[model samples]
Target: MNWNDLEKHFSSARLGRYRASCGGDEAKAATAYVNNMLLSEAMMPMLNVLEIALKNGIHRQLSTLYRRADWWEAWAGNPAFAWQTKEVVSAKAKLQRREETATTDKIVAELTFGFWSSLFNGSFQSVLWKDLRLVFPRCPKHQRQRHAISSALNQVRDLRNRVFHHEQLLWLTPSLLDLHTKGTEVIGWLDPKLVPWLARYDRLPASWDAFQPV
Candidate 1:
């Protein structure tokens, strides 16, 4: 029970009430907004993905095979689709959510990760990479690592699994900056672009690569 082992960065965050501002700095604002959206933003999408999924999944779909009145359906019908917790209702609901969301996660990985990581060969973030590309389309391109990106996304999916499973994520050092990158740990796959996003809104330092992976 050593209190010294714990280092906390999250202050109490009210649901959706958490906010940061870049004031009048548009450059700063875009970067911050994207970073928050990627991590926390993914949660919202995960909910829609699950909801739409529960309505549309094949084996588990709310069609002729299963209806909204079934126990499995009741399980999926719970309200806490995005939250991870120990309450029986939420835990069961989350499992249902993941069962549906995992497939789409795979789809996103295939579409974005390799192309995304190629933008950061020697350490730059997608935050700047994406915008910079938009600003400077002729910039030399980085080769895509299809397998690596796919693999990374798989890891990220596992993190998703843990959250939906309602397991204690206290040990998790999470940064929701990328929906496509993955590795053994979360930060290892974070894009530098996330830093600019964080900086834009949260006023973090320029060194986003410093966020160590656990």
Candidate 2:
């Protein structure tokens, strides 16, 4: 299809960055636009595995620390965890709306990635970090500080959001690659065994190599 057709279908606003990136070469812009989508598609599996590893790791640790499966219940009752409690309430409501019983597993599945990442924020550093830090068993003792883990989680979270939102990722190729590495590193920290399993399915590297000269 021609540039006009592409613009009409994708919207000029959406194609603006592509157009600019390719120096006004309509063909290149269209190629880049399609390539951007491919890159985004390639990223999903890695992000999916990373998020699952993170949430499950934290949940397992917290459960052991509290000696209960629904350890978030303790947080919900504590005034200091007001923000996290609000998220738990929202997750439960979402499950209820779906007519699914709000079991601990269901509630955990319903919670957003944002909710899980926010637990690493400074507000809960004192209360949750001590227990949460143990979630990363493979991470070196000296490198397992709350702030470092928080930064890594936030970076992956941002990249995940951008991909899910269908934002432009062509220009972010280098940084996106870095975040992908960081994400996989975090997964390894959670469980070294998971890295090889995740690598078996990951496609971002090949996708990036294909989108050369961008």
TM-score of each: 0.23, 0.94
Across 1-214, the per-residue lDDT of candidate 1 in tens digits comes to 1111211222223111222233444444334434443343334343333223222222232223334323233334444321211233344455566774423334232222223233233343422333323322222244223344334445555655554643322224554333322221223122334323333343112223322222
- Taking the tens digit of each residue's C-alpha lDDT, what string does model 2 give over 73-148? 8776678888788998998888878899999888777788998989889988888899999889899888799899
lDDT of 1: 0.33
Q: After best superposition, candidate 1 residue 101: deviation in angstroms?
A: 20
Q: List the residue pairs that clash in candidate 1.
A: 28-200, 31-197, 32-197, 32-201, 39-176, 125-192, 125-193, 126-193, 127-193, 152-182
**lDDT values for all models:** 0.33, 0.87
Which candidate gets the maximum TM-score versus the true structure?
2
Measured with C-alpha atoms, the lDDT of residue 11 in candidate 2 is: 96
Inter-residue clash pairs, candidate 2: none
**C-alpha root-mean-square deviation, candidate 2:** 1.5
- Segments of candidate 2 deviating more than 4 angstroms: none
lDDT for 74 (candidate 2): 79
Question: What TM-score does structure 1 among the candidates reach?
Answer: 0.23
